[model samples]
Target: MTNQSNNSVKKTVLVTGAAGFIGFHLAKKLLSEGHSVIGLDNINDYYDINLKYARLLELGIEKNEAETYNNLCNSKTHNSFSFIKMNIEDREALPILFKNQDIHIVCNLAAQAGVRYSIENPEAYVDSNVTGFLNILECCRHHNIKHLVYASSSSVYGLNKKIPFSTDDNVDNPISLYAATKKSNELMAHTYSHLFKIPTTGLRFFTVYGPWGRPDMALFLFTDAISKNKPIKVFNNGQMERDFTYVDDIVEGVTRIINKETAERIQSNKFYKIYNIGNNNSVKLLDFIKEIEINMGKEAEKLMLPMQPGDVERTWANVDDLIKDYDYRPNTSIKNGVKNFVQWYNKYYNS
Candidate 1:
């Protein structure tokens, strides 16, 4: 392990979705690397704020202390970690934060994320994902930030019959509003990178799941329902498949890419890059549930149903670019990943 105290040239990183599933883990990892991290999130009530608070609690920010928006709370546990409760779409406050924090690298993981929820609330997608991203681009442009890495999604490969989706493949056919917003983020990032020379890397994350996972994700929902002996919803009659990457794998890839020196981008005059960060293995929905069931020692009663709107049939990622550049390979198997999640779930909920 690198002794964090002896390291010089520590960059100050601003993680927008610090309270999110991936963001929390990334913030923790960066802090351990001796970088000063300024965590930001709206702490929305999309699912349960309790989970978000719990993640912040792990980052050394208490729920009561994090209630005040725009107030920076330094971490008692790690001096390098601090948090602020703020929305990315807040144009006024967001720029002020960028200026005040002197943030060099930005990881924009904040957004209204959900396929089904976007169907009824399309405006929310435009508000947070589009408008919020635009604000981030503008801030990076004006603030002279070095790199802007934002979260894209595999849903951008919507309706494509190709297996093992690649970053070079065309992503114009987004099936849902959420997918559309993610694609828009990529486009916006490229434009800013080209026009303003802000080096940007967009990660099209597969179905990421593990400990401290989001309650609305498939793995979390399945584990929660099965543990309580409630029936789990099986969409597409258990035929759907997903490239479920573990959260730690995603964080490792992001952290490496953040520090991987991008002088080549300037040499080539292309300051933009996108990569698919995934496990590279697609597992059936039913098989995934089986892993959860085995880990929990409980079988779930599944409610079989047709595929819902804004949902894809399957997702498989081709991580050749990620491995080629950053040498990122997601190594967690579904069984072990599920076991990790179940262990954390039991401890967190005392179930």
Candidate 2:
């Protein structure tokens, strides 16, 4: 890590899944803060490849250059930001990239996301989330990376009736393959931390939403359906509840964890830590939709439906640990968050 100022250290950070929703935001934030960021993503067609490409465009990597696999494309917008078209599961390529890049820290955000999709494509989950994560761990172990910050999901609290999910909660009984994989990540991170003494922090994010959000998430889907006069599926008869954290808040928590000295926070010889990053307040599903309706100036034709398979009823994260350690809590209200997304959505689609 190179000292940029008395208060900040500039690091060469490897941000995998850089084309993904949260990863894109984190990479941009890191670059703005004077860090050298290497953004990597396979650009898999899990959703819209164009959206991923558009995100890369925001980072100044042209679509033509971004499409080339195993090649590093320097950003035209930010000199400190570079992107590579690669998969973390590529055991051969990942190590070489690490060796060549001299990455001081790694924030592994690449994973096969979507809970329901995991059921339809179980093998995809194993390949990306399990095998791919193992490759990242191996690279970190060999390269002596200063810190590893990985994304964990709120779905890991599967089947737990607890209102506010805590890091101390028993997450052994995961309902979905997606949840199982995220739980597996936490366990894997713990093992690496314990064995190799790698300082690893896993952030279990809850219902992240805002600009450049995933098209599959409820906010994006609902906003799209409502705008198009299509019926939005209200699962569990709109009885769901979520923490509904904003993207900016999630990025803030991640950057703080990344910049903080790993040794200062870890316990005696224990280099593993996990924190739930959320809004710290759960909002009712119907109310959340109403906020979207207000922002979009259109009401959604909701198709009240039964709960889908592999879906949990509610998720409320206990972010006390994050507040205690970083003196930060996700404060973005759903009202403002929804409005921001709607504004971005209208502008993005209109343009």
Candidate 3:
């Protein structure tokens, strides 16, 4: 029999924020890969609690059973999936979770997401993104965790005019508090990786959109308004740009990163790395709306507006590194991506 210090070769993976848009997709992919997954989410009322519960239901996790603390719902689809209703900020609870589970890989996806919201409720961002992530990193270091991958946002690329935002670009000048915190997370992760010799990968995700996406994002918001025959706010007077990567593509890129573990310790300076997971295609905001108009069979009543304070004029990604190392392929075109999202929205809401 073979034995090692890491304990059972981490047959199970622990994913935080299993109920969130990206987190839900990530957990689903992990389960599909035949990995025993332990997912955690407090199911906060950040957006609609109903949507969060609905996602849990799709994973074959009973919403009723999630009523308890650390509620675990076995995945009917994968049988290896389990869930917990614990908050990421709960320091006491996390240590218990790490100690109890044979979690080899840790994906920290829990955070109070939203740039505009971060400006209003800075405390929420600090608690979840900073404090919560700290606990996750500490747990990983203490438990001899093999690899830790966490979500960092493209919002971290705030105030930068660099074309196709790359990992080599300087990201210290974040315009919004949300962006600042996200950039801080990258720095924090780097510190832990260097100091603890833990391999960490941070993904600077572009404007990710698709089925079960956040209502606040442009694709979801625009689709919802247009389908209801309502006016859609065209920010920057419809002169903005975004790299709207599809949800499935993002999941595929992330899944590959998980299994292909980093050999160099973050301290190796070579071990710690960041990648921009996005479609190289940057669609103009107006073109994106047009795609929606065509897809939904309704022309949006446009309300032209200047860019929001925390918003940037454009965001493009240079995914050369991602392709070179991981062959990260983001294949969903905006038209198809929007079409898929609208389909899910209509079916889910019975619109």
TM-score of each: 0.95, 0.96, 0.93
Q: Which parts of model 2 are misplaced by more than 4 Å?
A: 1-6, 72-78
Q: Candidate 1: which pairs clash?
A: none
Q: For candidate 3, what is the TM-score?
A: 0.93
Which digits, one per residue and each the tens of the lDDT, describe model 1 over residues 1-351? 111133436789999989999999999888888788988888999989999999999988888877854553332334788788888899888888777777889999999999999999999899999999999999999998988999999999998888889887889999999999999999999888888888999999999999999889999999889878899999999999999988888898898877765678878887999899999989999899999989989789999999999898999999998888877777888888999999999999995
Task: Write one digit per residue (lDDT tens) for candidate 2, span 1-351.
Answer: 122232567899999999999999999889888899998899999999999999989988889878654453332335788888888999888888887778999999999999999989999999999999999999999999999999999999887897889999999998899999999999999999989999999999899999999999999999999998899999999999988899998898888888887767465675888999998988999999999999878888889999998888889988888888876666677888899999999999977
Q: What would the per-residue lDDT of candidate 3 be over residues 117-204, giving only the tens digit for each residue?
A: 9888999999999999999989998998988899998998888887988888888788988888888889899999779878889999
Q: How far off is residue 111 in model 3, in Å?
A: 0.7
Q: Candidate 2 overall Cα lDDT vs. reference?
A: 0.89
* lDDT: worst 10-residue window of model 3: 1-10
Instruction: Score candidate 1 by lDDT.
Output: 0.88
Q: In terms of TM-score, how similar is model 2 to the real structure?
A: 0.96
Ranking by TM-score: 2, 1, 3
